[model samples]
Target chain A: MKDHAGARLIKDMIFKCAVCLFAFISLLPLYLILYYITKNGIMVINWDFLFSLPRPIGESGGGVFNAIIGTVMLIILSCIMSIPCGIAAGIYLSENKKGKLSNTIRLCVIVLQGTPSIVIGIIAYLWVVAPLKTFSALSGGIALSIMMLPVIIKTTEETLKLIPYHLKEASLALGVPYHRTILKVILPSGISGILTGILLSVARITGETAPLLFTAFGNQFMNMNILKPIDSLPYRIFYYAMSPYPEWHSFAWGASFILVVLTLALNLFARGISVKWKIQF
Target chain B: MTDRTMLKERFVKWVLITFALSSLLFLFLIFVFILAEGLPLFLKVGLKKIIFGFKWAPTKGYFGIFPMIVSSFLVTFGALVIGAPLGLSCAIYLSEYSGKKTKMFLKPALELLAGIPSVVYGFLGVIYIVPLVRNYLGGSGFSLISTSLILGVMILPTIISISFDAITTVPKTYREASAAMGATKWQTIYKVILPSAKSGILASFILGMGRAIGETMAVIMIAGNALKIPTSILDPLRTLTGNIALELAYATGDHRLGLFSTGIVLMVIIMALNYLANFGIKRKPAK
Candidate 1:
């Protein structure tokens, strides 16, 4: 009995140690990648790097200004396109409670969410670029809007559902119309959550390259035309990192750092809003 | 009741309903487009050739997906082997052992893991993991093993959070009863608590499998983009996502359609696993 108990204790100790070791190993890559990007990648991140446009192969003077501009454009366009549609869909799903139509819509959202971004890129290519005979910000924005839609809708629906039913009931008991109750009470309550979803979508769409690859068809310089080819941070990072030019490789790392920071900032901001909003409640 | 108020309420409901219908319609259009574009390739080439053909050269008019499919499965399996246990254990530790402070810190940290972009993970795989694998495992530059390790880490957050929710849901009454019967703490956990959470854990595993199978960017960056079936852990292999990402840019006609078919295959696998999770949820024993 002593022997068996001793063996079991040893086995338990071994298992705990193994788990700890595995957790450390899992974290190693994120550490290494972040370290490299900050170490070598930070050197190139200067005012010039941020302000100037991307130069041709082997040129070291220019920056990722065009890509940054283009990313903002894409995010704005995507948000504008997705917000109302996503919020309304989310509201409908949450309020309907249960039905065949609602279940089908829910499943459709899930399936759309599961579809790969690359496939979305391809279809967007066929839909927008092929017919228009141009690769543009509008195309990239629409592709990203599709990607953003399910995320926002799912999050918004969840947030609205989280709002207590009693609140809506109270407003209705006050003789308020349903629309006034929703607009004045429910939507105000859910605004932070809706914003959280939109911020996440913006952050996600900013870093995406595959969808933009087929839609934006990456350019080197800034162009304001929504109908013209545009540069984005992810595409620039992809193009520069793989190119034979040494200077371009450095630029790729810098672009990556900027992109990461932008995403992290958006994420942190959304988290802060959610936390503050929760505390208020 | 006021007529204007009734009209406004009806308008709001109708507008919301229309929005929902439009979203559903748009999703249906995507499916239709995928089927319209992808189904024809299978018809033209026959399912056998695409499924069984060994070669994947588009220029040569040959489009075999066997190797890519096999590699995707292998990587996902390897990742599960590495990730699932650690994740489950982490969940167990968090739920059963940790104090409030630790739980508070760890929960958010775990969630942050899932929020990190796939591209960043891919970058890590290339610069850090690939080299580490090359050094320890003696690979050329990159390998299936490296990709699996990175993906395993990436999926850890999903598994841990879900499993944690599951394990936490196991009632205190069971634990109290087992303790009253003179069962050791460890015994109660292993024999009673875990068994009760079996369905939830299984569902978590299925979700992890879905994430692993659908993953693209990280695997593409480290999987070496080779088409051959790997004989060893260190052997380079290419996945369906890797193939599409690398070659989709220049592909035309039949080749492009082949890529879409690969997407279909990926979706089918994921949907099947999702269904498995749904089944597990439905099969859970009533309290």
Candidate 2:
């Protein structure tokens, strides 16, 4: 009996050690990526790097200012396109929980969410870029909005579903119109969740490079025309990192650092909002 | 109800329904566009040749993607080999052994991992993993091993979080019953709880596999984009996604059509994996 107990203790010790080791392994890459990017990227960051535009080839010092502006524009445009549609879809799904239409819509959302970003990029190229006869910020935004749709829809549906059914009954008892109840009560109650979803989707698409590759097509200069080609942070990183110039390599690292910071900030912001707005039942 | 109010309600309902149906319309549009663009290649080159033939030179009209298919599978399987054990173990630790404090810290870290962009991951792979592999394994820095390592890291969040939830959903009574029978904690976990959570765990694994296979930017950055089958872990190879990403910018006409065909192949693979994952999730025991 003592021998069996001793064997069991040893087995428990082994399992515990294995679990701890694997957990460490799981975090190591994340730490290393953050460490390396910060170590290298910090050296290239400066006031000029933030404000200046890309110089011509063979030039030593150029900033990703154009890319930064372009990324912001794309995010704004995408949010404008995707958010209302996403919220309404979410509302419909929550309202009609069990039906063929809801099931079909849910399936479509899942499939859309799983579709490869590059494939979406290609489709956007066929749909918008081909029709426009040029790569445009609008096309890029349209592609990203498609990518953002499923997440927003899912989050909104889940959030609205969490509201107690009694709240809707109370509104109806007060003789509120159905449309007014949804617009005034349901939407306001779920606003925090919808906002969180929007922020998260923004974070998700901020670093998207694949869809923009064939849609925005990467401008070299700082131009603000929505109908014209534009540069973005991810596109800059992809283009610069692949180039042979050592100077461009540093630029890529700096852009990467900025991109990571933006994404992390957006994530933390969303988390903060969700925690702060946790409804007490 | 008055006619005015009734009209307003009807208008709002239709508006909401239109918004909802747009997602389905978008999905249909995507399928139609991709198929319309991609199917022409099947007629030009034939399906059997594209699927079974080994060569993939678009310029020479030899667009067989067997090599890319092998590469994508090898890389994804390699990532699974490295990621699955670590992810499952971590999930087990979180669900079965870790304190609340540890869970608080680890859960957020996992979220941050998922939030980090694929391009940032690709950059890191280029800067670190590529060099380490080239130094030790003796090939161009970009190789199957490097790509797999990066993807393994990328998929960890998906696997760990989902499996953690799965393990947590197992009834406490099962563990109590096992303990009452004089089984050790490890024995209870191994013999009882794990079996109950198997479907959920499998679902996470399948989803992670899909993510790893569909990954493009990172794979393109570190996989050398070579058009041949890798002979070893140290050898460089390209995937279907990588092939399209690398050449699509300059491709025109049939070449463009061929990339869409590659997209179709990838789409079919991902959709099948997704269906399998959903099935697994559906099969999980209700709480």
Candidate 3:
């Protein structure tokens, strides 16, 4: 009995060690990526790299200002297009949960979420630009909005659903109408979750390269027209990295580093906010 | 006197319903657009030629997708093989061995992994992993194996988090019952905890598969972009996503249509996998 008990204890120890080892192994690649990106990519960061316009071949000094501006512009435009639609749709779905219309909407949302970003780009190309005969930031922004909608709708609907039905009932019993109750009471309660969804959509759009390739294309010089071609950070990174110029490659690294920082900050911030809301499981 | 208010409320509901229906319309339009653009390409270029032909020189009219399909499968499988086991073991460990303090630290770290962009992973794989593989393996300098390894690492967090949640949800009573039987700890975990957690493990595995299959930038960066059937892990290969990314810029006419068809094929494969997974989960929700 003593020998059998000792064998059992030894086996338990081995199992625990194996588990720890697996956790460490899972983390190894992320560490390597972070370590290399900081080391190789940090050297190229400076004011000129951040502030000047992209340059042509053989020119040494240029910044990715155009790309940065375009990315922000596209993101803002996408928000304008998607936020109202996504939120309203989400609210309708939650309010009318059992209806056939809501069921159809729910299925659509799931399929959209799974559709690849590249395919979205292609569809945008066919519908938005094929008629207009011009590729513009507006087209790119619309494609991104479609991509962002499903994420926002899914999260916001779930969050709104979490607001106790009693709150709605109480407001209604006090002579408030359903729409007013939703607008004033439930939405406020669910705002944090809504913001989390928005932040997640923003993070998702920040890295997207495929959709913009055919829609927004890329511009080397800074331009502000929504109806015209615009440079974005992802396109700039793709172009500069693939170019033959060393300076272009360096600029790409700097842009990538910036992109990484922005995504990381937003992601971490969203996580922190969700925790602060202190929602119960 | 209250007629105006009733009218306004009715208007608001109508507006809401219109917006909701439009969201569904969005999905319809996009899928319709894909089928419209892609179906013509299949008719023009026989399915057999597109599927079986080896050469993909579109300019020369030798377009084939077998190499890309093979590469995608191989890379996805490689990632699964490397990532799934580690993730499952970590899930097992988290559920069976770790203290609360350890789990609190570990879960967030895992989440952080999910947040990192594929672009950064691509840059990392290119700079660090490709060279390591090249130096160690001593064949084609950049190869499918390195890309697969990077994908494996990138997806580990997804597998671990989902499976961990699944395993932890297995009732403690199950573990206690096994322990009370005087079974060894390893034996209890293997026989009792894992079996009970099978559905969660299966779900996580499917999610991981979805991620691996759809991944673009990281695999493109390290897969060497060679269009060939790789006989060895050290050979270069191209995947469907990478091929689209590379060719979408200059492609025109039927070439453009062919690319969309490739996208359709990818979507079909992904949907099939998702269907299979959802079916499995529905059949055995208890797991």
Calculate DockQ per candidate and list them.
0.48, 0.79, 0.58
Off by over 4 Å in 1: A1-6, A27-33, A244-246, A279-281, B1-7, B282-286
As a whole number from 0 to 100, the lDDT of residue A64 in candidate 2 is 93
lDDT of 1 at B175: 93
Model 2 off-target regions past 4 Å?
Answer: none
Candidate 2 on B1-287: residue-level lDDT in tens? 79999999999999999999989999999999999999988888999999888988777787799999999999999999989999999899888888999989888888898988898889888877898988987999899999999999899999999898889999888889899998888888888988999999999999999999999989999999988999999999999889888878778878888888999999999999999999988886745
Model 2: DockQ vs. true structure: 0.79
* Candidate 1 per-residue C-alpha lDDT over A130-248 given as tens digits, one digit per residue, 9 for 90 to 100: 68878888999989999999989998999999999899999999988889888999999999999988888887787877678768878987899999988888888877765667688
In model 1 chain A, where is the ten-residue run with the lowest total lDDT? A22-31
User: How accurate locally, in lDDT, is each candidate?
Assistant: 0.81, 0.91, 0.81
Superposition TM-score, candidate 2 onto the true structure: 0.98
Return the lDDT, model 2, position B1.
Answer: 72
Clashing pairs in 3: none
Best by TM-score: 2
